[model samples]
Target: MAKELDLIEEFRDLSLVCEVTPRSVKLGMLKLTNSFLEKVKECQKRDRKLSEKLVLIDEGKEDDF
Candidate 1:
């Protein structure tokens, strides 16, 4: 029937839209993940430097006593 054909067309269009929507969302999530990872790396580097400084300070204090 013509009505069945119309319903099928509508379903196909909706399916295509649903598939494309997730791909765009996935791309956006990838970008956000990369940005977050970069920030984490920078924080880790700063933390490592601070830890090294603390160790040096502790060593100097032990020498004084």
Candidate 2:
């Protein structure tokens, strides 16, 4: 929730800095940015979980060669 609000504020500031002319275009860009950020975060979380699982497996199993 707070993260989302921070992102929204950042987008607004970016748009202001870039001098984006139209409100609709600014909004469209913001939505795309938000969606991309969410996907990246989700991927990072999944990767972390997979890494932890791999570590656990390595610790629990013994090589039989």
Candidate 3:
């Protein structure tokens, strides 16, 4: 799961490497940027949930899941 999150982060960084010029290019870059950021947000949310579950498990609260 950590690895998956890392890959998503890398993709988010990659999406930031565009060079916008014309209007169309700018629009496309905006689309790509938004897409990558949404993906990052989703991954981060999942990671947070997993970490919270791990903490619960450590405290012997596995029934909460």
Give each model's clash number: 0, 0, 0
Summarize candidate 3's per-residue lDDT along 1-64 as a digit string, tens digits. Answer: 6775565566567665443343422212444248888898788777977879878999997966
- Residue-level lDDT of model 2, residues 1-65, one tens digit each, is 67756766787776643333435223544333588888988887779766677677788863332
Better of 1 and 2 by lDDT: 2
Model 1: per-residue Cα lDDT over 13-58, one tens digit each: 5543222242232112122248888998888778976667767778
lDDT of 2: 0.62
What are the RMSD figures for all models against the true structure?
A: 11.9, 12.0, 15.7
Superposition error at 5 for model 3 (Å):
43
Q: Considering every candidate listed, which one attains the maximal lDDT?
A: 3
Would you list the rank order by TM-score, best first? 3, 2, 1
Rate residue 4 of model 1 by lDDT.
Answer: 55
lDDT of 3 at 15: 64
Q: Between 2 and 3, whose lDDT is larger?
A: 3
Q: Which ten residues in a row have the lowest lDDT in candidate 1?
A: 23-32
TM-score of 2: 0.26
